[model samples]
Target: MIIYQSGLITLDYDPATDILFINWPDVQDFLVPEIRQALLILVDHIKSYDIKNLLIDSSRASLDIPGTEYKEVIKEFGHNLMQTRLEKMARILTPNSTRENKVEEARQELRFPIPLRTFTDSKEAYSWLKGTLAEPA
Candidate 1:
């Protein structure tokens, strides 16, 4: 069920799967600081509900953060996630090579403690989260 809805993002939680899906607003761009704050709020929801899996659909929203700011944001997000019960996260992004590369760079920098993957398809993302995909070697 949808727990939060705003012009920037919409949050939905599925109790059966214990997954929280964060859907970004279409045609909206957010600065690093704004994104960071939003992320903290999202983390709070995960903590409150004890959510273990997260699906972030970023196909619509664009991040307007610079390279340095992006690094900081990812660092803070990774730190906050570490304190939660989140075990896995799947991010669905638009098929933009530059944006995808930037996200991968940030992921590598964060060295996130839990499993995190990116996909261009939401179906594939959710399937992986549901453990329908083969485990990585």
Candidate 2:
């Protein structure tokens, strides 16, 4: 079942399926410091949960962080797990091609070890990540 910690974030813990759903908060604008704090908090939360497979739903979120600042924070949090075990990191992006392109560009810039992809439809994205015939919960 999914448990919303607050408006800022929510944790979808499906122990039966062994999948952790992480919903990034909807931030109209990006603030570097706030992003950093969020990342740190996220890392801790994930560790606490001991999740192996993570499905990140970033459809409602926007990342407007400066490259340098983002890099520093990501680097600080970078380790084996950030790259590993995060089997499928997918983003459901807005319709704007340019904005979508920007998100893809940022993903490339981050250079995370895990495979990252973006989709316009959340259901399709989830299906792709969860596989063609995953038994529904």
Candidate 3:
């Protein structure tokens, strides 16, 4: 079921798998503020629902956040996530795309590990989050 949605974000939940799928179809060339707003709302939903698993699909969306600001979004998002009950999170990014590199860089800049990863394949991500598949070795 869709918990919250707007022009920039769409959030869907699968109760059976206990997974929250956060879609960014409207994130094309979007900025930090827009993404930050969406993240805040997303985290709230997680807190309110006691969400433990998450799949963030960004394969179709593109962000335009500049250098430091891009890291800002990731940092803030990661920081907020630490306060939640989330067990694991996977992100789906378009394979062989610049966005993939950017996201990885931002994640590394966090300077600490979190139960999050980026994937290019949705099915693999879903399976991993569902505990039916293991993280790629």
Which parts of model 3 have CA positions greater than 4 angstroms off? 28-31, 95-98
Clashing pairs in 2: none
Show the colliding residue pairs in model 1: none
lDDT score, candidate 2: 0.60
**Candidate 2 residue-wise lDDT at 56:** 66
lDDT (10s digit) by residue, model 3, range 1-137: 99888888878999889999987674656666777888999999999999999998877665655646666677788888888889989988764365566667766776546577777898988888888886567
Q: How displaced is residue 81 in candidate 1, in Å?
A: 0.8
lDDT of 2 by residue, 1-137 (tens): 76446546677777765566777766656566666666666666666766555666766665565545544554655543464445655566654455555545555665667665566776766666666534447
Instruction: Give a tens-digit lDDT track for model 1, residues 1-137.
Output: 99877666678999988889988654335555667778889989899988999998988766555656666676788789989989999999765566677667777777777999888899889899999977669
Cα lDDT listed for each candidate: 0.80, 0.60, 0.79
User: After best superposition, candidate 3 residue 47: deviation in angstroms?
Assistant: 0.6
TM agreement with the true structure for every prediction: 0.86, 0.64, 0.85
Model 1 CA deviation exceeding 4 Å by range: 26-31
Please report the TM-score between candidate 1 and the true structure: 0.86
